[model samples]
Target: MTTYASGKIQTRWATLDDLPALKTLINRSIDALQVGFLSPEQIIASHAVMGLDTQLVEDGSYLVAEYDGVLAGCGGWSKRATLYGGDHSRDLRDPLLLDPERDPARIRAMYTDPDFTRKGIGRLLLQQCEQAAADNGFKTAELMATLSGEPLYIASGYHPLERVEAIGNGANVPLIRMQKILQP
Candidate 1:
């Protein structure tokens, strides 16, 4: 897990009430970064209902970054067994690419509010995910990163396996599958 040099960031478990703010963070991140990587319509529609927090509840793990007591970003992690759910995963083919039964943590729903970008909020949140996985007895954490999130994951010691392009709104949008292997 990569730790941030900055100390202004704080992370905590998210509650049900944080759903709305988390939604905004997800959508804003898409708007700021995905627009260029995807069509305007594809970006908007894919991120709209997909950002709803309820979709992530089954992941059984979530974390939020805060700046001055306000949410700056949120993400989720769970046991490695391809056990994941979200509006976005409903259509996933072979979603169980990773053995949820073997891997203790799968990271998903990562997003940092644009206003808080470059300030280490996303990095902190990712590190927090790694730590959470370790605390839960997992030796690795994985994520499928959006174009905008690739840099942060790369800088945080994540390695890319392959880039996959999917047909969304008739456009091919690329996503990277990454993982951070941790020592148990």
Candidate 2:
């Protein structure tokens, strides 16, 4: 766990118990934060592409950020083959474990509560995820960056490798594939 600035911020591994709150926060974040970055139709399609991946929680690899003891943000690194999207979004779920030496650890399901934006909650959760991945022997980390989240990923040392579209609900949402080498 980490604490910042007189205990205003804290971070810890997410548990199954956090699912309800996590779902609410994830939906809220997608609806509010994607406003300018996506067309109305694209935003609606985003719901089909982004959300909590229960596998992360089950793997004990997900982290949740808290501000004043309330959930502020969430994100986590994964050792599995899947790179992004909720379980409902994909039919061929790759549950295979990734080799840390070869596959980049996946940074999945990042979301910040709108009320907690600009409070470093995203940064806090991201830092934790990278560290956790490094500790597990991962040499690199990768994420599917939403149009609204690209800035943050770029600023955090991830470089864009490709721009792709997630197609669903008859709309296409743009996403950036980004990667970062973990500092030893």
Candidate 3:
């Protein structure tokens, strides 16, 4: 569909046809930005073996931003009976979402083309993820946000549940587990 942008752009629900391009864009972005944070092996494993293309295919939330029909950015989630923290007390305002058995949808992959960086594409993809989670009956959404993406997630309404050091490439990388309660 047509989208408003400085140039020709499109925003639409990702289909099977978009998977290959989306996967390539996500992998390229991660490799460019996450070299110090994620191991090369980890990056390849996550993107090649499992990512938005493979993981979010079965009843999971997935979206794409296209510039002149080229895949520019994407974000998505997958439902889980449990999450990292555990069930919110049915509260949107005061939620205690869990990581395990917490009725959450996991927001996993989000990426934008370097050429499209600083544009609103990332924000749009993130908001689309939230809406998809809510529509899928999730009371909340959660993600292990990267350092660069954390601020954007926070600005978009996600709150930090905990911050921990993740061992990657035999180095400690800070990871923030965050949640965003969705309105029913």
Candidate 4:
């Protein structure tokens, strides 16, 4: 738990009961923040292409942050091979468990409500994810960051690896792949 100007923030492992709230928070965050970086078609398509991966919840890797009793943020790290993408992604069919000794733990699906921006919710969630990943023997962390999210990840110690133009619903969406070595 933590407090900021926004209010008291609490985090917990996201459960099946939290799916609706998580979905709403994620879509709202993307809609509010992705403008100017992603086209409307791309945003709409990306929502379908990148909304809610149940695998994270099932694997106990997903978390939700709440501010004043409202869901403020959501994000997680994955032990599986999938790097990015939501439920509609074709790549989700094969969720091979990752070898943490070699493959970096994936920082996945981070979203914060517009009202809660810069209130420490994202940073807190990220810290928890990183610690959890390291505890699982991951030596590094990586994420496919949306343009709006790159700054946060960069500030949190991730460095850009490459620029990727991902295809979503026939639109090309630009994303940055970022990585960081976990502290032992």
Query: In order, what lDDT does every prediction score?
Result: 0.67, 0.90, 0.64, 0.86
Kindly report the root-mean-square deviation of model 2 from the true structure over all alpha carbons.
1.6
Cα lDDT of model 3 by residue, 1-184, tens digit: 4233434555776667777787678667866766666666655433332235343544435677887766788777666432222111122112234343356777766788766777778887777777767776778888877766788899988999999764443455566889888777
Output the lDDT of residue 33, model 1. Answer: 63
lDDT of 3: 0.64
Candidate closest to the true structure, highest TM-score:
2
In order of appearance, the predictions have TM-scores of: 0.79, 0.95, 0.71, 0.92
Span of ten consecutive residues with least summed lDDT in model 4:
1-10
Query: What TM-score does structure 2 among the candidates reach?
Result: 0.95
Model 1, which residues run further than 4 Å from truth?
1-6, 39-42, 48-60, 80-85, 93-101
Candidate 2 has its poorest 10 consecutive residues by lDDT at: 1-10
The TM-score that candidate 4 achieves is 0.92
Clashing pairs in 3: 82-100, 82-101, 82-102, 83-99, 83-100, 84-99, 85-98, 85-99, 86-98, 86-99
**What local lDDT does model 4 show for residue 38?**
85
Q: Candidate order by TM-score, highest to lowest?
A: 2, 4, 1, 3
Which model scores highest in lDDT?
Answer: 2
Question: Which sections of candidate 3 miss by over 4 Å?
Answer: 1-9, 35-50, 81-102
Candidate 1's residue-wise lDDT over 48-164, tens digit each? 323544534444467778887777887877653443235555555233434433664677777878788778777777777787777777777777777777888888888998887
